[model samples]
Target: MKIDAGNVNAVPSKRLFLSIIADYDLNRSICELIDNGLDVWTRAGRRQPIVIDVHLDPDEQSICVEDDAGGLPREDLGVIVGPGQSGSVATAHETIGIFGVGTKRAVVALAKQIVITTRYQHAETFQIGFDESWLNDEDWVLKVHQVDDLPVGTTRVELYQLRLLLDDDNIKMLRHHLSATYANFLTNPAVMIRLNTVPLEPRFFDNWAYPPEGSPQRWSGPMRTPSGKLLRVDVIAGLSKESSPATGDYGVYFYCNNRLVAPAMKSFEVGFTRGQAGLPHPKVSLTKVIVSLNGDADEMPWNSSKSDVSTKHHVFTALHDWLVTVVKHYATLSRTWEGQWPEKVFVYDDGDITFNEVDDFLTAKRAVLPNLPVVRPRLPVRITKANSGVAQAKPYVVGLYEGVVAARTLVKQDLSQRNWLAFNLLDVSLTGALKEYLVNDAGAELSSLDLAQLINRDRTVSADLRARVPLPDPLWTKVEQMGRLRHDLTFGRAAPKISDEQLAAADAIVSEVLARLFDVKLAA
Candidate 1:
């Protein structure tokens, strides 16, 4: 082999396409483009509110993300396709683009043909296109052309000939993903993002608080990394608004440089132990942990996709123990609150439950979390040890009334259930009593006309009988009443409806019938 030059050919192979984009799905890919626009806006000092519009046209099999953030300078536009090249000039703590491959990877992952149109501030519009041909070859050369009649001072990325055509479900998911990913940015009154003409609404935590005593905890401090970068960390743990226990909506969330890197993470990696021993309990569904890390983008403990945390990273490793401790503490408190705490309101006795936002706590001055007021062991505790004298007994009386109402409700419910049960007992008892009197005692067959006649007679007719038979008038009357009541309840007949008094009478009748007739005593 003749070595004309010692330089190695380092052009990226076509296989690089799969490697760069393999991990991204439709939602995350779109997020990468959004991140680029926001990063550019930050780099340009955010002179005006950045308006990013995402339009997903399934019928056209295309997506267009246009942003009013300052467009790329023509000289620097090559960075869009050049691996490791970047146009961002943001400081370590201000940017979201770190590896500089997010835009290119997102473009290729989405479509075969990509057209990026841009116009630098007060400059002629320029456009560049990347197609299947360019993707198939190893050539790094690209041509940018001046274009007219285009939007000025803006950048537009259009992806057509989609690699995976979007459907309704994909569009819905993309909307949600973008809403969550840029929640911090969208919270700014200046920023506006639209998806399919509808404005994007950010999803942030709605934490619960009973102020002065029970509020979310906050701890924020700056730490110097081993590499000497200043990293700021803020951790807030508290109760969130009610959500389904089965959902991932109530757990640890991570944000790096105001971008949501992970949402509602409740696995072993984030201090939720495996199995039922830990956070899986329904009582802890209100638990919310928000961790904000703002610092050098490269130093943050996040993966390239920004979809997960890099647990092995030293920064995260240092944070893991503390994170676990904090989560466990709040999770225990959550369980306790659900199990013991009364209605979470500032007023102790009576008011609708109110909650303060988690952001309020996150922004508060750093301090040790105040211990929650001792949750009364029982709800509506009107007669605590501190309570004294006759006037204070008014609280006890009010509590007694409330208790009476609740007890009455429960008793009525039990009575209703017992009525159905008593009906069942009536049928069985009548049959058993008849068998005992006719067959076992009087030694007569059940089919005998005399026995049937004896049992079927109404209370009036049976009242005249003086034969000293086991078929008594009282039993007959009780059976008839129970049967009619059962019929009325089952068929929605008129009332003499089921009540506590009626249930008690029925129970007494059943007990007498069982003991006097069927020989089975009702257990006390």
Candidate 2:
């Protein structure tokens, strides 16, 4: 095995670039291009504003992303051609995209042919383009040339023959992701990002405030390790503007050398410290904590993509100790306030529509509400806001099965959901099964057995409240039919979660149905 080391590795795999791109989706792929542009802009000291424009055209099957940052310099031309080479090392520490493959990988993921044009302030304007058809060749060359129309201090990428359709849903998704991805930069007046012709505004975390204006800083300090290495941690804990899901931008942020490596994270999520030991309380989401960190690169642990921060560092352990002390005082009022209302009613919106307006719709064919997405549990709901712009919209008409089903009171449905039920009772691997009824031609997935027949079904909602919205007579018939079909599939019997293979197949089918739903929603 230890013979002469004369084996020479030559001719790198040409498909490596193309294959790595498969890991990124439309949103992530688009973010890669935007990140490169921002890096150059930040590297230039942010003295002037940078305007980013994205043009999407489905009919042409093309997309163009342009930015007014300092374009690629002639000296750094190898940055793109080389797989891991980076020019940002000498530039700003906060600049993103050090791997150098961002723009190339993203552009390749979207189109068969791509043209990249750039103009540095001092260097001549140049353009380079390549086609996917050349990916198989071991020695493919990019046709580079000087360009006259390209302006100085600008970088642009034109994509042709898109692999993914530039449809409306994807366009909206791009807009949403870009705004969130660059939320920190877009918050500044100097940076403007536009999708197609529309300007994108940075959406902030519903839980925490940024920069806090003149407000006193809640927490800021440097955590010292056994050695002299210093890990700086800064945090601000505050109330959210509105109630939102805990998963979104609602927690701490971690930055490595001024660039954000992790964002909107709760303390417990990243570490094994005492603060993370407790289960997340229902009120935990109301508190937004922006925890910014800065330290030597080697001291911090960022995943390869730089999207996640590891909790194994000593600084994280120290920060956890500090957070546990302060978390008790942060957003503790939400729980006390909720005690006044019934468990079904939680604080939401500025006082407009409540949950009742959304889930309380009339029964329709195949459980699909004509006015909304899909209804769950039961229905006869509608969501309408008031005409006055200043006043937030409240439930216009609180539809009541109005004492028809005994003395039960119905709970309200969240208004945020328009197309699908916001809450799922089967919040598990089977959650997607709830929506499978919409797309599966095999028939409704609902059980033939009545929900009331299920044990402790009343625990889902107050019976008096739930009984107010009677199960539509038509639904019971569907339940019966599905029950019979399921029984036949199992040889005249029913079993709880049949087989591992069946579970995997069910998951695959659900994924296909959701994909189709996306296609239908975005179809021209």
Cand. 1 TM to true fold: 0.69
Those runs of model 1 whose alpha carbons end farther than 4 Å from true positions after fitting are 1-7, 90-93, 209-214, 274-281, 336-524
Q: Write the per-residue lDDT of candidate 1 for residues 195-234, one digit (tens) a residue.
A: 9999999987744553344456666677667777777887
Question: Candidate 2 — worst ten consecutive residues by lDDT sum?
Answer: 360-369
The number of the candidate with the highest TM-score is 1
Instruction: Write candidate 2's Cα lDDT for 1-524 as tens digits.
Output: 67786877765676888878776677767777777777788778788899889898988988899998989987677676567766675322555676666666777788888888889975789888878667767774666788885766898889898888778888888787676667777778998889987889876553322212111134445655556666565565544554555455545566565445666665554321343323445554554555566555445556545566767655565455455434433433333333222232233222221111112111110111112112122211111121122112212111111111111111122333211121121122122223232224323334535322431222232343223333344443332333343345436454323343433333333233223322111010
| lDDT score, candidate 2, position 45 | 77
Where model 2 places Cα greater than 4 Å from the true spot, the runs are 1-3, 10-12, 90-92, 206-217, 223-232, 246-268, 271-283, 294-302, 311-524
Which one is best on lDDT? 1
lDDT of 2 at 270: 37
lDDT of every model, 2 decimals? 0.69, 0.52
Displacement of the residue 120 alpha carbon in candidate 2, Å? 1.1
* Deviation in Å, model 1, residue 142 alpha carbon: 1.0
